[model samples]
Target: MRTEMFVDGKWIGATGGTFASVDPATGEVLAELPEATEAEVNAAVDAAARAFESAEWAGMLPAARAHVLLKAADLLAARTAEFAQLETRDQGQPLAISAGFSVPNAVEHFRYYAGWVTKITGITAPLSVPNVDYRTRREPLGVCALITPWNFPLMILVWKLAPALATGNTVVIKPAEQTPLTTLLLAEVLAEAGVPAGVVNIVTGGPEVGKALVRHPKVAKISFTGSTAVGREIASEAGRALKKVSLELGGKAPSIIDADADLDEAIEGNLMSGLLNSGQVCAAATRFYVDRKRADEFASKVAAIAGSMKLGSGLDETSQLGPLVSLEQLEQVDRYVQIGRSEGADLLTGGSRADGDLANGFFYRPTVFGNVTQNMRIAREEIFGPVLAVLPYDDADDLASRANDTDYGLAAYIWSRDIGTANRLAHQVKAGTVWINMPPLLDAGAAWGGMKASGMGREMGWAAIEDFTEVKSIWTSLA
Candidate 1:
């Protein structure tokens, strides 16, 4: 893997020194990556800004821009296995997931946005004033700083990068310090795909680099995916500079298992959605609200399924779940597990970290807490781990209200045989995305974001194009 930062289309070493990129599955240092200081961050933004204003990129036709993205998609698809392995190694997700979901999704984002490049349009307005021709133009925002989280490193990077590039905006990306390898690899892919020099720049580091990127005056927009606390800070800083910002932040998504729901399907769906990527997803269904009548049975099956999951190295094809991103994450998840116990929630199956053969890695057992109240921290806070808090709901009428009680409203899941009831609850829920009788599946065409503290703006589909571009009104005298 490339250890240096990619700035202005050139690879350079960092002045801030290097840090070890440890593999979470084995607690092994995979590579040492250069940490970007403020100097490097500024250099990246400067490159992006210069590229944004350059004739090579800025003057390219929509079709030509789309070609670059499509070529990148083809290149990525051809190297799926290579990218997936690196993603699994860097991010601690199972190789199956990296290959099946993450890498494929990244490819789809590129292709999807490539299609949208020519479709981005503004309307000509029929004005009240006579002899005046009025129209609006949707234009690129220029020099976007895309900050992605450790959980879904390469996929989420493409989530922001695809749209920014589709809208003709240059970007400076800051992948999470824990998982920077795949992003670095993608820089090579973008460059090889004929993306102009400096059109896409990458600087890898910790929070200090992110702060510098956000504070850079040349950055016209900021697209972030991570914790809500950090999102709030970025929003505040971007607001001060009056830069456009889109944040896909933390989520405490609730999954509702209604009385009439198919029990088998609901249990399996919950297991997959709640435990996928070891429950590191931002829109993960961490909170489950079951009808009181079936709560006991539902919790039992979920606990059994979670317990049956195999914890091993992400490179192992048979491993259903892998380790947390780091020891720090593992400790945080365990701390929340303890908090759940103190709040009187019952630990149904696994609670502590994994032992025996997996002792060296940062693996936490897939845990489910029963008898969890709405007031419990596990049910309220965003615990980005493979831990589920199942809460019982006494009435169907109160289900939506109870699920919406948390500060997060990113995504929610509802399982019901009755479409009317499912649709009703889906409408009642305040989250940005809601699924009925299905596991959490994302599409490149669907709008993904949140309500309330979860986030500020959407990331996928046309909404993403809007977020990355600006609208300008123009009036011409026809008389």
Candidate 2:
């Protein structure tokens, strides 16, 4: 295992010694990762800065850069199974999910952004002054710092890196301490694909390392995906430094089930949407707003479906739900379940950790709560686990009001047979992305992000490329 910092084209051991990477599924010590110190982080940022100024990286043609990204995608596809196993072992996601969704999506991001390499455009404008000519172009921001969360480490990392590199920006990545293994492995993928040394650097450590990256004077932009609290901190630091940034942060996303909605489809969607990845997903539908007429029915069905989900090792295909990413995450979910009960929300099912064969893992069975109110802590907070809060609404106006009540606006879902109602509600809902009769559908070409306290800026698509580039206008006398 590569348990060292990848800086300046080479892997070096951390000066701060090593830290253990435990398998969330079995609580076994999987590997010892080097705890990169502040010095190593600085080295990474400096390396990226140097690479951004180098001809080999910064001056590479767009088509040539695309070739490198495309090669990386091919290499990733070839090793999908190997990387998927590593992801499951480190991130506690099901092997099938890691292979089918996470790994492949990482590859897709690279390929999709690869197409954009030669397509990044410039604009020619008609100048107000007859004697003057003006043209606008986008240029790379050197030395971007990417901070990714543990839940979807590889995929989200690629989400930021693809566009940053495609736009010609060098980067320093700080993967979450819990799941830095696969990201460390990505260095090998990039190397074999012929990405120049210092173009992509990775530093693995705790929050101190992240803080250093965000505040580094050499870093030109910050792209972070994690909690709102942490995102805010990074944004504040970036603001002080006058650096560009993109944040994909927390979500208390709500799913609405109208009276005319497909109950079975909503139930199934909830299983995949709310409880998928053990509800560690930032965009997972944690808040449910069902029409009063079908609230009890919806709540009961959710409880039953959540209860039936099998919990075990991610490597086991039979296991529908894997363990929480860590013991700390497991405890957090348990605490929220208790808070839901204490706050008078009906605990329809599951409020404890799994036992027996699954006891060794950080596994918690899916939990569902009914009669949830907007005011309750369980409803208001981002639990980041497989706990659902189901609330009822009597009217359309009330449903809209309640759904838009929270400070978060990352994503929202609506299920209804009435296309008119769904369309209108989708427009009214306060979120970056809205899904109608769907389950959190995401694409590399579509922008993904949040509003309000959720986060700032966007990721994915051509919009993501815009964040990493600075627009410059050239003016000259033509007469």
What would the TM-scores of all predictions be?
Answer: 0.99, 0.99
- The top-ranked prediction according to lDDT is 1
Q: Give the per-residue lDDT of model 2 (tens digit) for 31-118.
A: 8888888888888888888888885775898889999999999999999999999999999999878999999999999999999999
Runs of candidate 2 with Cα error greater than 4 angstroms are: none
Q: For residues 1-479, what per-residue lDDT tens digits would candidate 1 score against the true structure? A: 77888988899986878888999988999998888888788888888888888757857998998999999999999999999999998889999999999999999999999999989889997989999999999999889999999999999999999999999899999999999999999999999999998999999888998999999989999999999999999999999999999888889999999899999998888888889999998888888888888889989999998999899999999999999999999999999999999999999999999999999899999999999998889999999999998899888899989989988999999999999999999999999999999998999999999999999889898999899989999999999
Model 1: which residue pairs collide?
none
Score residue 231 of candidate 2 by CA lDDT.
Answer: 89
Error of 1 at 59 (Å): 1.2
- Which stretches in model 1 have alpha-carbon errors above 4 Å? none
Question: Could you give me the TM-score of model 2 versus the true structure?
Answer: 0.99
